[model samples]
Target: MSRDWTSTLVRARSAQDGGDLALAARLLADAGGDPTAPDDALRLLSGVLRAQGRHAEALPLLETLTRRRPTSAVAEHNLAAALGDCGRAGDSEQAAERALTKGGAAPETWLVLGRARTSQGKLAQAEDAFRQALAQRPDFLPAYRDLAQLLWMQDGDLTRMTQAVAPLAALAGVREDAALLYATILRDTAGDGAALQSLAAWVERGSVEAALAAAAAASGLDPRLALQHAQRAQAQAPHDQRARLAVLTALIAAGRAELATAGLEDHLRRDPGDQHARALLLTAWRLVDDPRALTTEDYARLVRTYRLAEDDAADRGAWLARTAAALRRLHPFRSHPFQQSIQHGAQSMIDPRAAGDPDIDRLFEALRAPIDAYIADVRPGGLAPTAGGWSMSGAWSVKLKAGGLHTDHVHPRAWVSSAAYIETPPTVEAGGHEGWLRFGAARIGAAFALPAQHWVRPEPGTLVLFPSYLWHGTEPFSGSGERLTVAFDLQPA
Candidate 1:
């Protein structure tokens, strides 16, 4: 039996080396006679599943392996990686620390630790972990990627960003992910011209990955070029979903929203139940000036039913004031890059449930009725049909000072989105609509030519709910007082 298991493990390794992961997993799972076979099978099979992005499937096996071999640094590292991939960032970080304590020195383990820290909004710690990984293995590609992404997320000075990425960017073909990150930083900070020059040079070799990266970089800077590169990516990998999404995104960004309708319609025809595509289609309708996208009746429905009721509270004004104060106290006010609208300001990480403020918690509870009403009334027909209950996948508070504004963008992951004005800036210019929410404009630098279709004046104690795909941003305001608001996303259960 021992001989058979040893041979089976050897065969499994051979299969994995030959890129037959399915065969490797099957062989490992079936080799169960010997006592050590289970451990070997669990270890190998977890790796196989994780490589395939089946992290949920890999998690239980890794957990069991970790329990069986608590002292094995490799097992603990693998478990931490699985946990990170499955979105258990806090747990994954703890497990990764245990892996390090158990003497794990693999660059991949450090990369996992870095990613787990990133998810938990620990940017400095994440950067250190990634740097540590790179220090151990200079040629490690994953470490380069993790480090570059972490650095890009920080609103650090231009010199700091350039210094960190200069060494890695100097070696382009060696690490494609790092090169892409470098291009993104340049595109966002310097100008479209500089980023396009670098991206264009990189994609001249006609690689699909390079083309995809170029498409992303050119997305807002040069929509035509973005479309061309996205089309190239689609041509190279016709069935790739990312390529398809890029094409759709480029079409909208290029000010050719009318042309995007057909592509979205065709995609929906093939995959009727794709919620993301459906949401994009809804936004496309609005972009092309279609009335069916968001009619007067829809706006009326939102106005009538969506905003949270003030009558539910004992004292509406006092409740809102206290809620705002409590939320402000809960967080240490960090500069999280996740909020695209905030600049020279602070934004809270997404997690209203764990915010530890009774007033804020009460406000979220008060928002349920309007959320339920929007699903029943305003949501488009082809979108995800909700059956009453919904989850707040993300929630955050934003404090924007003078000249601070959220850039125009859409929430791709949300089904329904909202902003509740917890505190408002005094004297919103009625003519200019400063500090008000405007919809239907693309991000800056897109040159998308279309003007905003709708604007909602901010009022304290009122919540405005809109489709997640709608491009929205705040009009820049000049004032001494801050504009504090709580935003949340609602996804169907």
Candidate 2:
């Protein structure tokens, strides 16, 4: 089938420019043209795939592009980035080195190299690469952020991260983010006092971000002061989620959940897809015994568990043992990452496509039936969204040490969420429901706390699925060994 390669490329570019990426990808993929000569089409197709979070699908196209333009530094850099995105850190590192060799030490190349090094658990090497990037481009904001995050993850050394990024924070374009980061870091690491002191000047001068930070730091310490700060932030950014959420949290903490219910309901009425707001509203209504909370939550009907490998000839215990061993090798960090509920455990990189894990692929395939059933169950249940289908948002494995447990939290940005247990501690069965998954407990204290309505015993080769808005966490258990699991989220497409 003879085809015009140039004309196809032009049409593909038009679709891509007009935001019809699926059309662009289809045109490029189906075009019966010379794949090697039309390297531009390959590049464009790869970009389209990656933009849709199909990193694995893009890799071959990028590899072909690099092969076609052997000496092109940009091609090598793109391949390096794609490799990293696909969770092939070692190959990404090699490609980044090739990019640096050909491009003469471009800062972006150095930044990618640093990320690859970090992924490989080479913290010292990663730091050196990040320093090299900063040395080359003094005003690169990403370099500062990555280096600071690396420092924080490596050691909880707040001073080191602050000192490292201070100069770059002074740059005109970087100050706003740096200020916000500084506030959050202070509140997380030090306490409310440090955050309040640091944000005082900015808050007084009408910085909505600073006021929100002030609200967060003071929430539990001084409820009235926190509410005031949140109100100030809300006044500035009337429609911002951060401000709205801050004000709501403060209002609830001050024993004014009834007052916050109207606002939360209004937000949900306007955007029912806001799982975070929905979760908060549930908490507020439950606190005041609004009756709607229990009906809306519907834990009995909505939350379900499945025992995996039931149909397979292999024993479930053996399957779980095999899967657990394979998953442990993917986890690289010794400590949990920031902004996650994982307290003292190591978690695998998000959405890892560990090229050859057949057990993983099989397990995921088995999950499709249950997920499809749930989608069908929800569609006719009065909230039939305009969005038709659901797709996986992210996937990660968690290996919780003896004392580790995820604090109660909701997947605010997702529609559905899940966890599949590969390993469980003996403590789970010995006594109590330790190491068990509990649902419906709001992550708060005193009168504001909503006790868990349901609990699921952790079993090897089993999974639990529920709405992402449900407040959930695991009970911490101590003894020996680790509790290993894979978790993922889903969103409407």
Best-fitting candidate, scored by lDDT: 2
Superposition error at 439 for model 1 (Å): 2.0
Structural similarity to truth (TM-score) of each candidate: 0.74, 0.83
| Candidate 2 to native Cα RMSD, angstroms | 4.1
Candidate 2, residue 195: CA error in Å? 4.3
All candidates: CA RMSD in angstroms? 6.0, 4.1
lDDT of each: 0.72, 0.79
Q: After superposing candidate 1, which stretches have Cα over 4 Å from the reference?
A: 1-66, 78-92, 112-126, 139-155, 234-259, 272-293, 302-345, 355-360, 379-388, 427-432, 443-445
Give candidate 2's error at residue 349 in angstroms: 2.3
Best by TM-score: 2
